[model samples]
Target: MYKLVKPLLFSMDPEAAHHTVSGGLRSFCKLWGGKRLLRTAYGCEHPALRREVFGLTFRNPVGLAAGFDKNAEYVEEMAALGFGFIEIGTVTPRPQPGNERPRLFRLVDDRALINRMGFNNQGVDVAATRLRQLKNRENLVIGGNIGKNKLTPNEEAVSDYIQCFDALFDVVDYFVVNVSSPNTPGLRALQEKEPLTHILNTLQQRNRKGGVSRPILLKIAPDLTHDQLDDIIEIVRETGIAGVIATNTTIGREGLRSGERLTAEAGGVSGMPLAARATEVIRYLATQSGHAFPIIGVGGIHTPEDAAEKIAAGATLVQLYTGFIYEGPGLIKRICKKLVAG
Candidate 1:
């Protein structure tokens, strides 16, 4: 079905295609027996596929990465497609319209996407409400990927993260502190040791309050140096955060086969172009940290083998975004089957 539909979607603008597909799925799943039908076609279950990570039981280790469902609008819709988890938002405390149009682009030749969408979202409160209203959350593990507003200065970024964390703490299963997106001006600066420690420590302090705390993970850029990753290990240990999401997206365009025009587009590149580097980061973090914490590996996973690669490289879980767009929902089931077969 996706093979038949792919060409038509490819003809539309990348972002428009995303909206169309999201809307179509939401509407389709509303019909009688709709969710059951989708489950029949796409869902996979096996004891071997189940995983216990960060004290959470995942039906499988495959997850829908953030950015795809930035506002928590499609949690149930995506859950029906056989993901073990769904992450929503790079949400901010206040609503902001992100970067300009043509912010999301598809590089068909290289099976990649360059997006400068910034952190455009409807704010954390809206996402929290939508998540709170989820009626069929059985076995659903949702993560809130939180970030600062673009307009917020670096000095005040901790407050924005705190606000988002508090608003979403009750609703999300886990929290991903996002200081890694390259699109937001000066946002990556927070990844530095001094400021990054401040933000995580602040969140960790709040997370311990009220006798309940969620697993907090740091999402880091693939562009980080070995020194930076070492610092990341130190930070995770120091802050007592749960783990790390090895990569966000990379600004480097080292080996893209796409034309110069598309490659020159200013944003982070994700998809096949990021596969090796992402896995490398995961392995580094795992080995360097002596496998002390879980890692959610995501980037350039367009096949079951790619998913397996992340796991083999020490990713406790794996996620899909560009690969989900390019390979369709069947990719999720295929990955689960492969894991079970092993």
Candidate 2:
């Protein structure tokens, strides 16, 4: 099991182990009667877990967030693990190698992660190709979280988002415009009002004219002030966009239990320490916007209580990234079952 292998995995370089886990899943799922076997093992058969949102029906409410499966590589494998939905890709119009190594770190004592991975992905075209090959599933909703390449100047960032939208329209069920990753140089600046409006407005126009008009949502960082969050809510309403993912990861490191050793690691923080801040953002969004649209709450959700907090705060659905790394697959079932039972 993962518990036994985790120590070995923890010893490897974080990024390398990430690729290894993803690659290993791909290989394992290819073996004799593989993917179907996973469904039997990891799947929850309860009907109470089903829920509908975003005009789609999810088998469960828990989803795997974008960074976990960036290139659309293991949707089938992850789907087997009983996540109701999966958002793949912070993919760009073009691919880049991302930030340098040691870019990802485990703050083990705090049950958190700090990663400076700068949207390194295999480009939208490559991801779209694989996505197109997926056996269609109306049940398991897939969200495509798209972003610009790191080297692209922020001025032309909208072009990258637009291209990714056009390319992945036929494949993904929903879209998340990711402008909040801390690792990307100058990317978070796009979340500011003027630039955020420009990027979202362009995508809204395209979606209106497109073949399959999937719902589009913006993902925001938790570090924003009340004024900035108000700008975000205004833009969401103005653009007639779908919704918001309440948070990305946090740039702030205040009051972390991981101590200063982790304080020195230059990256975005997520996991248990992020729970209060992310839920606070969700609650703020809920209160400010008059509950205008849906919200996908993510960050530090590793327990049934955490999931409940997200729902209570106003997230129609929730996602997990660091939680999965720390708590393993059981966390999904636990959260989902708790939600369903309640």
Candidate 1: pairs in clash: none
On lDDT, the candidate that comes out on top is 1
Q: Return the clash pairs for model 2, or none.
A: none
Point out where model 1 deviates above 4 Å: none
- Writing each residue's lDDT as its tens digit, candidate 1 over 81-134 gives 999999999899999999999899998899999999999899999999999999
> What TM-score would candidate 1 get against the native?
0.99
Candidate of highest TM-score = 1
Listed in order, each prediction's TM-score against the native is 0.99, 0.96
Q: Give lDDT for model 1.
A: 0.95
Model 2 backbone overlap count? 0
